[model samples]
Target: MDVLAVEVLRIPMAVDLAAIVIGALTGGLLAAREGFAVSGVLLLAVSGGLGGGLIRDVLLDVPVVALTNPVYLPTVGITAMVTFFFSGWLSRTTGLLVGLDALTLGFFTVIGAQKAQLAGLPVTSVVFIGVATAVGGAVIRDVLLAQRADIVQPGPYNAVAALIGASLLAVLAGPLELPLLPVAAVVIALTAGLRLVSVLRGWSAPVAID
Candidate 1:
């Protein structure tokens, strides 16, 4: 591969790993809350860590890197172990889980959009792909835990935040001629910031009245 292609691939991997670590931490905490065993915690961690990327790759018709590469598994595994052992500390660290989860949402959103752009998908499709990647893991996690998916739930504008961020990045990168790195930074910041504000301010979509 050429230098630019290699760089693109390398950058995604960094964002993917960051998302994985944060997702694993959140999954570990959830498993602990449910009184899950070590094995269960690890399983949940892997699901949350790699699930969204798997969905994104599948949608893009690309090889799932988590399956093909050794690094992803080990990185998530170590993160899960640390999270499992330090559950108490993590729990005590107020806002840590929420912050990490929001950041992960942003990372996945950007990853999905960039991949779709590289695939030469249309702008609308890129936005949808970004939203899908952002929410796929949470949907899986919710199913496993027997809880409502965040995207469907009535609070905090989880997927909406991702959509806004992803759409913003798509516009900036596609039309405004911004570099991918700066585009990604703005997307992550906006996505995470929106989520944080929503949570703190109790923002939610309007409910249908009977």
Candidate 2:
């Protein structure tokens, strides 16, 4: 492994584990709202939680973490359990679920950029991969559920937040040589903050009505 690769590997696996939990929670909440059974919740949880990482690894030409890491499976499993236990409370709040989804998007976007940089991909490629990583899972979830994806529709700055977060990661990686955790933190905070603010302020990209 190269220096960047080694550095990236040194990043605590717990971060990705945490993201998996968050993704599962979001997925479970969505499934419950959609009147899915326990099996459906598990399916969505696994799909949503690991989907981004799987896509990222494939794009980077590496083994998918879902296949290689035992940690990934249990994390989603635990998340499903928690969601199952707390389904009553979580199912009542759609906004909270949306917030978690936005957070997942931010974290995954940063992770994608970091991985791409570690793989020595170009900055532009890293950005594209980051956006895909952030939104890919939700796209899959939506397609599976047969609903319009939030990233594709006008809801908030979902994709924009991912793009900005990825751009920040790419710029920071190139110059500051920041550690993965700090870089991820900054990117996630910025992206999630922008998303929350957009939600609160009704900020959105203007579309020209043809």
Candidate 3:
């Protein structure tokens, strides 16, 4: 039987949307800690939630999911408000924010890769879009917060993890013709796990040599 004889591994669109909400929650928490007002919180949250996918859609020449999906806007908006109000409790949890951030990184990387592939993009473009989408929101968030983007800073393996995940997608789902859901799950686990370990252990990606 052909690959189509079995059901493919596409994750439901609704489940994938949790990634945007998680990103927005992180942004809202950051805004709260920064003493940003309601407007500022909303701005950062929206940027973090939708920025990466916006870039992906624009580059792919597709409709922006944030604008097109009714649930996207409202869900992210509510996530920001919740994070803004309950930031104290959220922060008190052990590594909760960082975990969520890493999780979103994994989700974005795989999602971007899958979307690009569905668009008939090249492997290189798929990886690029995947990595860009994973880190784009954090770049925007840090810029708005007046700090250097963490991905650019000599910090943990944020982009590196995304790179690994995207490349894995290129290999496993693209050429190998494996099930996308399992491939996506593996990508998310490795990407997020690598990120979490790097953060917890203070493992820095190699910096530019002098």
Return the top candidate by TM-score. 3
Kindly provide the TM-score of model 3 when superposed on the true structure, using C-alpha atoms: 0.91
Stretch of 10 with least lDDT, candidate 2: 4-13
User: Per TM-score, what order, best first?
Assistant: 3, 1, 2
Q: Which residue runs does candidate 2 get wrong by more than 4 Å?
A: 1-5, 92-100, 175-182, 208-210
Clashing pairs in 3: none
Off by over 4 Å in 3: 1-9
Tens digits of per-residue lDDT for model 3, 19-46:
8888888888889888999998898898
Relative to the true structure, how large is the alpha-carbon lDDT of every model?
A: 0.83, 0.81, 0.85
Best by lDDT: 3
Model 1, span 1-210: residue lDDT tens: 254356557566676678888887788778877889999889888888888878888988888877987898898899889878888888887577788888888888988888788878888888988988888878888888788776786888788998899899889998787888988998999999999899999999667899
TM-score pick, better of 1 and 3: 3
Candidates arranged by lDDT, highest first: 3, 1, 2
State the lDDT at 104 in candidate 3: 87
